[model samples]
Target: MSTVKVNDATLERINELKEKLKISKTLILEIAVGNYHSKFFKKKEDP
Candidate 1:
Protein backbone atom coordinates (compact mmCIF):
# COMPACT_ATOMS: atom_id res chain seq x y z
CA MET A 1 0.00 0.00 0.00
CA SER A 2 1.17 3.55 -0.81
CA THR A 3 -0.03 7.12 -0.76
CA VAL A 4 0.65 9.93 -3.18
CA LYS A 5 -0.40 13.54 -3.02
CA VAL A 6 -1.79 15.24 -6.10
CA ASN A 7 -2.21 18.97 -6.55
CA ASP A 8 -5.58 20.56 -7.12
CA ALA A 9 -5.21 21.35 -10.81
CA THR A 10 -3.97 17.90 -11.68
CA LEU A 11 -6.66 16.28 -9.60
CA GLU A 12 -9.30 18.39 -11.35
CA ARG A 13 -7.94 17.39 -14.72
CA ILE A 14 -7.96 13.75 -13.74
CA ASN A 15 -11.55 14.01 -12.62
CA GLU A 16 -12.54 15.65 -15.88
CA LEU A 17 -10.82 12.99 -17.92
CA LYS A 18 -12.40 10.33 -15.76
CA GLU A 19 -15.89 11.61 -16.54
CA LYS A 20 -15.16 12.19 -20.22
CA LEU A 21 -13.36 8.92 -20.79
CA LYS A 22 -15.57 6.95 -18.41
CA ILE A 23 -12.64 5.19 -16.85
CA SER A 24 -11.60 4.72 -13.26
CA LYS A 25 -9.16 7.19 -11.75
CA THR A 26 -6.86 4.32 -10.83
CA LEU A 27 -6.75 3.28 -14.48
CA ILE A 28 -5.96 6.83 -15.51
CA LEU A 29 -3.03 7.02 -13.09
CA GLU A 30 -1.81 3.63 -14.16
CA ILE A 31 -1.78 4.57 -17.82
CA ALA A 32 -0.06 7.84 -17.08
CA VAL A 33 2.63 6.33 -14.89
CA GLY A 34 3.15 3.47 -17.32
CA ASN A 35 3.62 5.90 -20.17
CA TYR A 36 6.03 8.00 -18.12
CA HIS A 37 8.03 4.95 -17.17
CA SER A 38 8.21 3.69 -20.75
CA LYS A 39 9.28 7.11 -21.94
CA PHE A 40 12.11 7.46 -19.46
CA PHE A 41 13.07 3.97 -18.34
CA LYS A 42 13.29 2.06 -21.62
CA LYS A 43 16.53 0.20 -22.21
CA LYS A 44 18.73 1.60 -24.99
CA GLU A 45 20.33 -0.64 -27.59
CA ASP A 46 23.64 0.09 -29.22
CA PRO A 47 23.36 0.59 -32.94
Candidate 2:
Protein backbone atom coordinates (compact mmCIF):
# COMPACT_ATOMS: atom_id res chain seq x y z
CA MET A 1 0.00 0.00 0.00
CA SER A 2 1.56 3.28 -1.14
CA THR A 3 0.75 6.71 -2.53
CA VAL A 4 2.11 8.93 -5.27
CA LYS A 5 1.52 12.64 -5.75
CA VAL A 6 1.75 14.48 -9.04
CA ASN A 7 1.36 17.99 -10.33
CA ASP A 8 -1.91 19.15 -11.92
CA ALA A 9 -0.57 18.88 -15.45
CA THR A 10 0.69 15.33 -14.90
CA LEU A 11 -2.57 14.36 -13.23
CA GLU A 12 -4.52 15.74 -16.19
CA ARG A 13 -2.40 13.69 -18.59
CA ILE A 14 -2.88 10.56 -16.54
CA ASN A 15 -6.63 11.11 -16.42
CA GLU A 16 -6.75 11.59 -20.16
CA LEU A 17 -4.76 8.41 -20.74
CA LYS A 18 -6.96 6.49 -18.36
CA GLU A 19 -10.08 7.58 -20.24
CA LYS A 20 -8.55 6.80 -23.59
CA LEU A 21 -7.34 3.38 -22.46
CA LYS A 22 -10.52 2.60 -20.51
CA ILE A 23 -8.46 1.66 -17.45
CA SER A 24 -8.11 2.78 -13.86
CA LYS A 25 -5.68 5.50 -12.79
CA THR A 26 -3.98 3.01 -10.52
CA LEU A 27 -3.31 0.71 -13.45
CA ILE A 28 -1.84 3.63 -15.37
CA LEU A 29 0.45 4.45 -12.48
CA GLU A 30 1.50 0.85 -12.13
CA ILE A 31 2.34 0.58 -15.79
CA ALA A 32 4.29 3.82 -15.71
CA VAL A 33 6.26 2.82 -12.64
CA GLY A 34 6.92 -0.66 -13.95
CA ASN A 35 8.19 0.65 -17.23
CA TYR A 36 10.40 3.19 -15.49
CA HIS A 37 11.88 0.59 -13.21
CA SER A 38 12.52 -1.84 -16.05
CA LYS A 39 14.16 0.85 -18.11
CA PHE A 40 16.36 2.21 -15.36
CA PHE A 41 16.82 -0.45 -12.74
CA LYS A 42 16.33 -3.87 -14.25
CA LYS A 43 19.43 -6.06 -13.96
CA LYS A 44 21.13 -7.70 -16.92
CA GLU A 45 22.06 -11.33 -16.75
CA ASP A 46 25.58 -12.52 -17.40
CA PRO A 47 26.05 -15.01 -20.17
In model 2, which range of ten residues has the least summed lDDT? 38-47
Error of 2 at 31 (Å): 0.2
Clashes of each: 0, 0
- lDDT against the true structure, per candidate, is 0.80, 0.79
Model 2 Cα lDDT, one tens digit per residue, 1-47: 55876889999998898787876766889999999888666454322
Best by TM-score: 1
**Alpha-carbon RMSD of each model:** 12.6, 12.8
Q: State the displacement of the C-alpha of residue 5, model 2, in Å, after optimal TM-score superposition.
A: 35
TM-scores across all candidates? 0.40, 0.39
Candidate 1's C-alpha lDDT?
Answer: 0.80
